[model samples]
Target: MKKLFLTLFLLSGLLVTASCNNDNKKDKKETETVEKETVEVKEEKVVKTPTIVGVAAANENFTTLVAAVKAAGLVETLNGDGPFTVFAPVNDAFAKLPEGTVDGLLKPESKETLTAVLTYHVVSGKFMAADVVKAISDGGGTFTITTVQGGTLTASLDGDSVILTDAKGGKSKVILTDVSASNGVIHAIDTVVMP
Candidate 1:
């Protein structure tokens, strides 16, 4: 009787241990699966921000500006991690120039001039419309900023609009204000500002 009771007890204990081990393995697998699912969910929620070049490329009005930037070899510079302020010109702005001017600038020989003109539209730091307006107000209604092309641009308010004066006395009105980008801000102009 004692031997039979001991044998029965040992078998029951082994069976219970085996059952617990199987449950533990199942629980571990479930935990791993849940963790993987969580990681996948996090990845799916991530959002990508558009850069200055990306913003220009996406908009129809900035197609000419985008082409000019590419021709000037400034795509990488604008795509860099900078807080630049760009005064972007619309297609009509380019049309405001004399005939054949755009075609001439797009040529390889005029790369330097094209670069200078494009960089002239960019400032080193980001300046939104409100910041520009405040600067204008603080500076006796006119604000002077240095461009990346080693030229100075004057900003002043005309009614509710901001006017940009170029080095060659050309005036460009900011028709669209505060187009935000990952690396900078863009202000669309009706006329191309010359360096």
Candidate 2:
């Protein structure tokens, strides 16, 4: 009888210990799952915003512009903490140039000229589409702004579009507007304005 009692007690103790160990394992698994979920949430919240260079680099249409910016060594300037207003020209805009024009400008010897042309598209401050429209209105139908290239660009409203005239009397129409970046805003133009 004593042996039977001892066996039953040991069996009960073993069952209790097994249940406790199972509970501990379950608790640990739950904690690990919760920790993993927390890490996932933290990763989701850490999404990085696109800078001006990032924006141009991500878009297929800006490939030519991106190359030009790299060749001109203006990538660092555009990527800097600038609240710049960039009148970005699309690939079609560069295509509109005469044959060999882009090729010639991209050469190492033409860096200065290319830099001037690229900088001509960038204004010092961040100007949204609305701000540009207001400026045009405030300036009595034409807003004259200084480019980063030290040249003057004239902005005027053509119906709903903004037209920019360059120093060399070249005009480019803004096609896409208000593409916000971490460093600035981009207005994609239909033509590459000359400096």
The top-ranked prediction according to lDDT is: 1
On a 0 to 100 scale, what is the lDDT of residue 156 in model 1?
97
lDDT tens digits, residues 73-127, model 1?
9999999999999999999999999999999999999999999999999999999
- Candidate 2's TM-score reads 0.81
Provide TM-scores for the models.
Answer: 0.82, 0.81
Off by over 4 Å in 1: 1-37
**Candidate 2 lDDT tens digits, 26-105:** 99999999999998988886556688889999999999999999999988888999999999999999999999999999
lDDT of 1 at 164: 97
Worst 10 residues of 1 by lDDT: 41-50
Error of 1 at 85 (Å): 0.4
Best candidate, TM-score: 1
Go through the candidates in order and give each one's C-alpha lDDT.
Answer: 0.95, 0.94
Q: What is the TM-score of candidate 1?
A: 0.82
